[model samples]
Target: MLKIIIAEAELEPMPRSLRSLPVMKKKYGRKDVVLLDSNYHHTSMQTLPDAYRRGRPDIVHVCLLNALESPLNKDGGLEVYVHTRNDKVIYIDPSWKVPKSYNRFVGLMEQLFSTRRITAGDTELLRMVNKTLPDLITEVSSGMPVKVMHYEGAPYEPDPDEVLVIGGFPHGDFVSDLPFSRFSIHGEELVAWAVLNHVVYGAHGT
Candidate 1:
């Protein structure tokens, strides 16, 4: 299986600091956990550190949608995980159909963060665990080669059963030190979802 880890994703609930903001309180109300979205909370995020790279749940949403809908996943050849900036890892079931609506997607994420799991009857479709990126890699890699996607790295080629790490934030370098081979499909920077699509379809040969 081609396991993928979207490391340092910007997906998270509204931080405690931002919870009291007028915009947040007005939009999300008194919910204990609300998904932090740059589109909806841009002004509030500016005061936070590394603001440019934060508050982008849309990136994660797009990446998940692209990965889960790909032919490779349907064929049982792909596995995906989302590792957030807060050191939370989201385990995804390949059969889970991500909500197409961005608003609904955000709601689902808020619920997941609040409840820690989403189940479809008896099967768990999504679950959040407290895990660092490196730990997640070690658990899922299982001796397969680990590759990090970067524009300045070595030329890329599809390798079966390898674990790939792609940045899930909108901008800036990874916050964690990823000790893995970096590979590139393009010389210029591409958005996370775009790179994911290219890699998934390229691997799927479709």
Candidate 2:
């Protein structure tokens, strides 16, 4: 299996501080929780710390869409996880179909944030756990070598069952320093979804 971890993803529920903003309230009336989106709340986010890198759930959205639809995933050779900036880990079922519409995807994520899990009848399609990125890595990787995708790192080579970590933010570096070795397939900086697609294709030797 090729296990991919979208680490330090900028995905989270709206903070209490932002909830009071008239723009936020106007956009999301009476909703106690909603996905923090920079595209929709850019002005409100400027006051927050590390504002440039936060409120980018769209990064995670595109990454998930690519990973879940890739050839590796269809062949049951891929496993995907999302580790949010807030230290929350999202577990994705291989069979779950991600919504193609960005708005719908955001809504699903908001629901997941509020309820902590999305269920299809009895089988859970998505679930969130309160765990740090390192802890989650330790659990999923077992004894497999863990590698992170980085442009400055060594050239990447695909290894079966290896845990691959990709940054899920738009432009900045990861907030948490990961100890794993870093590898890169591309020479220049690419978006999270582009890198994810590269990894997926490389895994299948395509």
Candidate 3:
């Protein structure tokens, strides 16, 4: 079985903090990413590698989409956990229907921000896990070695009793206490979704 963890994912609904950015004269920014609200504002970093910091939400979303759609997921060969920026762990339901539209997807994810716990089953994939990143990784390790997808390490190789931790953040490397065997599939940085595809496909073959 192959389980995938997206750690410290930047995925989120439009944050009110984004209201502080300078408004541009376009609906979508120069990067072709959506502007959050009526202000049409974009942060300075928005023009950088990650536009509006929007890639994370989309990255997390597409990762699940591909994972669930994979043959591995159907045969119980795959499981997914997404740990978000606000310190929430969403154990995604493999059976959940992913929203095809941006607005609907926003509605689904916005629930995670509330102080109240959401009650849902196959529909709401966001299962509120109160565990922090280190604890969550420890629990998932389950007396097995944890494999981290790091650009600095060697190419990835699947192992029995191993869980792979991939970076979910658009920028920055993972800095944590959990023990992991770092490995790399490629020298350059691949987008989160691309990395997910490679890992899932590679693991499925072994």
The Cα error of candidate 2 at residue 175, in Å, is 1.8
The window of 10 residues in a row where model 2 has the poorest summed lDDT is: 197-206
| Native-referenced Cα lDDT, model 3 | 0.67
Candidate 2's residue-wise lDDT over 1-206, tens digit each? 88999999999988899999887788789986888888888888899998888898888888888889888899999999999978999999999999999999988998998899999998899999999988998999999999989888899988866999899888878768688888988788888888888878888843
- lDDT of model number 2: 0.88
Tens-place lDDT per residue, model 1, 1-206, is 78889999999887888998777788768788887778878887888888888888889988999999989999998999999988999999899999999999988998999899999998899999999998999999988999999998999888867889999987888878888889999999999998898888888843
Give the per-residue lDDT digits (tens) of candidate 3, residues 1-206.
78788887876444434434455323334432232322233444354434534435666777777888887787777878888765678876777666777667645666555532344553555576666788788777787767888888877877745688888876777656656678888898877778778878877757
Off by over 4 Å in 3: 13-41, 44-55, 115-124
TM-score of each: 0.96, 0.96, 0.76
What are the lDDT figures for the candidates, one per model? 0.89, 0.88, 0.67
* Candidate no. 3 TM-score: 0.76
Q: Native-vs-model 1 lDDT? A: 0.89
